[model samples]
Every structure is written in C-alpha cells, then in structure tokens.
Target: MPKGVYKLPEIKNEPIKSYAPGSPERQALKQKLVELSKGGLDVPMIIDGKEIRTGNLSDIRPPHDHQHLLGHYHQGDKTHVQMAIDAALKAKPAWEAMHWESRAAIFLKAAELIAGPYRYDFNAVTMTGQSKNAFQAEIDAVCELVDFYRFNVRNMYELYGMQPNSAPGIWNRTVWRPLEGFVFALTPFNFTSIAANLGGAPALMGNTVVWKPSKTAVYPAHLIMKVLKEAGLPDGVINLVYVGGKEAADVIFNHREFAGLHFTGSTGVFNGMWKTIAGNMDKYKSYPRIVGETGGKDYVFADVTADAKQVATALTRGAFEYQGQKCSAASRAYIPATLWDGVKKYMESDLKSIRMGVPEDFTNFVNAVIDEESFNKLAKAIDDAKKSPDAEVVMGGNCDKSKGYFIEPTVILAKKPDYITMREELFGPVLTVYIYDPEKLDETLDILDSSTDYALTGAIFSTDRVNIEKMTSRLTHTAGNFYINDKPTGAVVDQQPFGGGRASGTNDKAGSVFNLLRWVSPQTIKETFVPATDYMYPNFLED
Candidate 1:
C-alpha cells in the first residue's frame, strides 16, 4: 500500500450543455442521434465481462417513434440470472481485497469519459431510446451520471476518513468492509444516471453487483456497461442481464450470497421484493441492505400570496418534463381559489404554447411516455377524469398512439380535493389540480398530506414568510425532497441528497455519504499498547 494519504480530485457538478441550435454539442448530438437511430444494435447479456447471447431477442424501439426499430436486446432466463450470480461471487474475493483507492480511480475515470468524449453519445442514446428531449437527455444521461460518479468518489473518500477517537494507550480504527456477498441492482428506466448509480455505488464500495436494468431502458444501460469497462472496471464487477422480474428474483432472493438490493421503481414491486427477502431470511449469509426509491405522487402547493404565473411555469416544467416519468415529477397540486383563475389562465396559455412530438425535434417541449402500458394507464385516467362530475379536463387531454405512445401534457381540475386523479400516482404527463378555499388553508394542507401514500417530492410556493414557515412545518413529512418556490424535480447530486420515506422509499439519501454507507459493513478494531498480566485489581488485595 502507498504510505501517503491520497487526495481525490476537486469535486464539482458537471456543467450541463445547453444544446442550443448551431452549437457544437447540439450539432454533434444531432449527428449521433441520426447514427444511433439507424445503428440496429444487438445488445447481449454482459456476464463476467463477456457478452452472453441466448438468441431470445426482444425488439428495442423508441417511445416517440415505436414503429422505427432501433435494435434488439437478447432476453435471458433463470439460467442466465444464475450465471450472473456465479460470476459476481467469483469476482468478489479479488475485488473487495483490492486497495480502495484503486477502485475509486475507475469511477473517477468513468466520470471524465462521460464529461468528454462520451457526452454526445450518451445524450443521443437517451434521447432516441427513452424519448427525452435534447436538454433532458443532456441533464440526465451526461450531467447527472457524471455528477453521480465524481461526487460518489468524493463521498467514498470522506466515508473512509471517518474514524473513532483513540485513547492514550490504545488506537481505535474503523475498517469499512464491503458486504460479504453480491449486491443486486434493480434500476429504473426513466433516468440513465439512476441506472448507473444503482450499480456503481455498491461496486465503488468494493462489492460486485448483478445489475438488471428496466427493459425499457436497455439502450443507455448497455452504453453504461461499455463506459465502465473502458474505464477499467474488471469483468464481473457489475453484471448486466435482462430477464423476467420473477425469474431474476427467484434466483437472487433464494441465493445465500445476496448481500444487498439497490432499487428504483414502483412501490408495489419494492414491497413484494421486501416480502420475498424477509421470507428467505434464514437462507442468506448476511442480512441484505434493501435500498429503494419507489413511487411518487409528487405535488406543488401554492399559498394565496404566491405568484400565479411562477406556479404555472413550475407546473409546466415539473409535471410535463420527461413526459412526467420521473419519480419526482409533480403529479398533483393544491392551488388556493384566490389565485386559481390566474394560475389556470397562465397554465392554459403555457400548455397551449407547448409542443409534443419526437425527441429529435428540439423545439418539442414534451415527448412520448415510456411504452403502451404507461400510455393506456394515463389515457384511462384522463378519460375517467373527463367523465367524472368531480373533475374536468382543464387542458390537453389528448392521447395518440398511431405512431408512438404519446399523451399530451394533460391537466385535470378536481372540484373536490380527494378525487382519484389527485390521490393516485398517474405516472405520465398528467397533472391534477384541486382548487381549495383560501380561508381553509389548514384544511387543504391536511387533505394534501393525507390524500397520497407517497412522500417522495413536493414544492410549496408562498411570498409571505409566515405562511411559508407554516406550510413547511405542516407538510414536513409529505415529501422527503421538499422545495420552496421551485419545481420539486431536478435534484442535483451532493446538492440535494434525494430519497423519501413512506411508500416512496427507504430514505437512504442517494448522492451522499449516507447512501454509500449502506453498501459497507464496518468493523471496529481496537488495539491496546500494553498487555495485562494480572486478572485481579489492586483494590481486591487491599480490601
């Protein structure tokens, strides 16, 4: 080991590229998008640093242009999942024993690669595959992923430096050890950054991981594997596979070497997985660390004193960005009747001005939702709202799937606060607004708090400091990532350590030392300077 205490690179958030027309990034990314749209890739299961092809191919299509074939990803079964587990276990011995700084260097290099040569490629893939517009892809696939890597490296260093106090005759030390077995990373489709970090965080802590990205997100997921490998990540450190959820879980949860699960997805799935892990507790070598950020019915609340136009802008971006597929997207709102008309007028104008189509069109503010299932769900919710006496379609209630799974940025106004659209998590470009009596502010806040099971992300808008303070206190636990006078989405790494409680997730805030700490099992070592030869004390003899 090197005797000198090593210092990491000065950490900073990666600057987001504007991708303005005629700019170099924009032109390069547009070219890359064209290339990828015709690439026709054959994605395979990556186990032990080798691509394993079973020949069971599933079509990969862009959400915005479903008919156009992007590629095909080979689907794996139980056997492939088993192979992944075996590969991860095989790699664990050498990986955990390697010097920690060596591991950090790989991710640091990955960050650099993402920020430089790979930036356009990543953003392009995200755009075509996931239907994120140029700016959205820029923030998510490139900027946020880079931030996760660089900030996590810094966090890992800070984590290792945390030590216990030493006495005059003894030295106390804490050794942060990787979990005894492999971590299973179940990543979501919405954010490529999340998919990378779900697997990267554990592996950075010296644990091997079996990564299973969402089927809808395989394009960027494959790219992430390529980036990590080029950055010198050893074979089997993180295995990427595509298989049915039940099939993967049956193999993973039943295994003795399953040490942890890093997940981002639905509340129902996380609950089921937790149940399965608990039922199989006796079979595991160590208790698995279950970390997940699940569903969110994220909200935006405006007080009587708030700016109507500002709230409208926040709603426009927060609710419809990424087609409202984000875990932190604003899905519901509680607007006071005093400002509801102005808010509604501004929102209508904003929604009218917004354009929705393929991500290739930079002028389009919104793109398609993930797939047909999501489209159907969102469509039904809009239809239900239109038919209901308690609600009315405020604006943009259209759903079109002729070429792709597209749903216009829909906003539903609920006469009653507890309408289904206001309560349930409709994960699409649909925002439900419930107008409340300004005099009954406390009652409205209560309804907002109790209406949803989620406590993921929310925002409060108020110019009055007294109401601001009151609203903050009242809705304290309603959102884990709460905001003031801003949209509830776009959580930057290290700046806003993100996660939530309630049905949302285990609030092990990612993008910080707290999330990294979950991956490690520490051992405290206390060494005494002198050995005691006698068992009896001096007072025993004197007495």
Candidate 2:
C-alpha cells in the first residue's frame, strides 16, 4: 500500500435515502426510533478508551417531546477532561507510528458499518436525540457521516501521494507528519455528521484527539463512538469527554502538548477560545491550528427572470428544513419587485402545508428547536419583529412551548433592507425578505455582501446567464458554497465541500483534502543517489 506504487481506489459519495412513507428503510428507522425512546440507554465518557461512569447524570430528551426521557449520560468534571487529554497524548506516539493504510482502513470500515448494519441505529438515535424527521436524520447521520468517512479516506491517500518531482541524480519526497501533540475536537448539535467528523478527521490523519460533543447531541455522539470502536479504532486514539467548554479550556489550552482545535459552534465561543489560546501562546509547545464553522446570516437573491416555483421551493426548503437549525440555512432573502408577488404567493402556501410535531410522527416536516434557550431567543425575535413598523409578519409567527420547544415557520417582510433579522443570525425557522427594485440588481449584491459578518452559504436564482456570471463574480466572497438556482441549505458532503470564511470559519471545506491538511504538518525527504565528496561544484569552480 506504499504510495506511488499502489493505486488508490476511486471514491464516490454515499447515496442518500429518501425515507419516503411505507418504504422498508423508513419502516426500519421508525421501529428503531420507538425502541430508543423507551428510556433505558446509558452513556459514559470514553477516557483512555475505557468507559468512565461519574455519579453526575444528565437526562437526555427529544426536543419535540421534552417531557419524556430518551436516555441519561454520566457527566464528567475537570478531572475527566484532563484524563482524556493525557490519554490522547500517551497514545499519539504509537498511533502515529502505525501504517497509514491501517489507519485509513479503520475509517473506511466504519463508513461501511454506518451505511449498512448500524444505519438504522444511527438514523433512529439522531431522530430521537435531535428531534430530526426521518429524512433529516437519514441525510445527516446515515449519508453525510458515511460520506465524510469514505471521502476523507480518499483524501488521506491522495495527500500522501503528493511528492516533489525528482531529477536523475536525486529523489525528493514529502511526508505528511501528523500534528506533534494531541488535537481537541469540539462538536456542535445541529448535525451528527459534524459531531463524528470533527474528531474523526484528526484521528484518521494519525493525530490522537480529545472530543467533547455538544450537550444536546450526547445520544448520537455515544453511538458514533460505538461505531468507531467496533470498527477497531485503536484505544486512546480518539477519547470522548463530557465536560463543559470552559472546563476543557482550562485544562487543554494551557497544556504544552495542545496541537490543534477542530470546532463547530457559536462565534462568541470560538472567538473567546482564540483569545485564550493567544494569551497563553508563550506556554504552549507550538502554535495551535484553530479550524471552526460558526454563525451565518446567510442570504438568497432572485432575479426577475427566475421561475416563481423554483424560488418558492427554494425558500420553503432552504429556510425551514431541520427547523432552520443549519448554520447555512437562508436567514435573509432579496427578491426583485417584479417577482415578489408571485414568489410570495407560492412561498406562503408552501409554508402553510408543513406539518409541525414530534419527529416520531412520520408525516411531520417541522420539529421543535433544540432546547428552551433557543426557543426563548426565537420567540423574542418574532415578538420584536411584529412590533416594529419597518417589518411585517407575512406568515406564521406563533410559538407555544408547553409541550415542546416549538415555533411555527415564520417569514418577515422588511420595508428597509437593514432589518435586524436580515443581518443577525436567528438560527431558527425564520426568514426575512427584502423586496428590491428590479433595476437595482447590482446595488442589491453590494448590500448582501456587506450585511453579515459571516460568509457561509448563499444562493442566487437567476435565469439570465450574464447576470448569473455577474452575481457569481461580484459576490464571490459572500459564501463558501454559492448555489445557482438552488437553495443554500442541504450542502452535500464532498460535492459542496462545506465551511466558510471571515467570522464564519477557516473555510477548511470539511469533506475535501483541505480540512484533512490542517491536521498534519508536512516534512520533505530528499535522498542523494550520487556522492558529493568534493565540496566544490562546477558552478563554484574557477573554470
């Protein structure tokens, strides 16, 4: 399996299942979801590859049915966070010494396990834990996670194959060295795939990791650890820790062995971590690699030539899917005055048909937001919008949290383009629209580019080829994944290569080689085939 001699296998994306009604896959997932919600599962933190059960227990419940307990996890303190870091550092020497092919095989096998045997378990747990409908769970846990594992394996192989061009007298080569110290992976709740990939990417690149998952995503994170373990991932290579972000910060950032950070969460937290790391920079062995994906005030724009149905479908799915919890979900839209009336009519009716309830209900498209904090934030935003003179609640703006944290699909029309909702990241199923004069298409692009601090994902709906090219060129820095006549949500792994810049993230492009590159430091290797016993060369000679 040595590079340059051995040919790497072609990699393709994992197919996404529709999980339509009455299908065998849907039926299987439904049965698993019911079993998971019975409330008997126990989760423990994996420190030194050994399960540690602290007395501190945290109850896990579905966001859509907050009254019922789905499971309980043992919480760890600062001691556990330190233990996990120590374990990862202890395991690094041996893990990094192992053959690259051996490391790659483990993740590829894990991908197969998720795509086949454990598919139902992964999807079901994601649905019950995150309150995602069947389709959402399938796309995220089953498909996207599989894609990250498989595609990342290919990326590893391809990266290793890169060698310097050699001349007749000598051979030059580059060896990708894993980071010198342990990496920390802090994951988020919106996508289970992210929870898996954040740690898995560093581990596959031969760097040991201390993974701390979001509190809301512990259930699915547990299953991810199980799959990786069953796939024969080496013990201590990737340790799972259940500790608060601050606890981790106190223990990890000060350690001389702290090498890198792979994070996906709030911008404020990432910024804070950056400041802390920089403050303690003198105490560390090396400058840490900080890669993150944060908040996005993402937007969508439609030209007068675009189809009303296309714009309508894009808005309905883009703004509301997964309860608009996606970092890339369209929060603001700029529509031309000519297309506003028709796009609005279709978009309103489309939102009206969406069913909001528990994820267990197969037909429900809208589920509750993650927790009460998120619910309150969204509820207040809607109330403020309704009271403002510059904004009009065009569609649903109601919220009732007695049973679960539920907020109906909402749309706000802003008289001015600079409405608060248009610029801030609501991170809920709320879309703010700003109607623009069709003649000022160029001016609207300028507004969209500067309105948000984050540059994550965006879309442009236009039938005109010239205008499409112009938008693509002018708003190049607005998003990492820019869509043409498509919604900004649902960024496919490998194909879309997700992440963004500015306040959004480092734009590592998670499913591509770029993200994996950050986990390693490359070293050049050169061999002199001929002896250079004489110090003098022809060029240096007096000839």
- The worst-scoring run of ten residues by lDDT in candidate 1 lies at 1-10
Q: What is the TM-score (0 to 1) of candidate 2?
A: 0.98
Name the TM-score of candidate 1: 0.99
Name the candidate that leads on TM-score: 1
lDDT of 2 at 373: 98
lDDT tens digits, residues 1-543, model 1? 457799787999999889887899888988998899886799998999999898999999998888898779999999999999999999999999988888999999999999999999899989998999999999999999999999999999999999999989999999999999999999999999999999999999999999999999987998999999999999999999999999999999999999999999999999999999999999999999999999999999999999999999999999999999999999999998899999989988998899889998899999999999999999999999999999999899999999999999999989888899888898899999988888999988999999989999999999999999999999999999999999999999989999999999999998899999999999999999997899998888963
Question: Taking the tens digit of each residue's C-alpha lDDT, what string does model 2 give over 330-379?
Answer: 89999999999999999878987899999889889999999999999999
- Candidate 1 colliding pairs: none
Model 2 off-target regions past 4 Å?
Answer: 1-5, 8-10, 539-543
Model 1: CA > 4 A from native: none
- Measured on C-alpha atoms, candidate 1 has an lDDT of 0.94
> In candidate 2, residue 47 scores what lDDT?
82
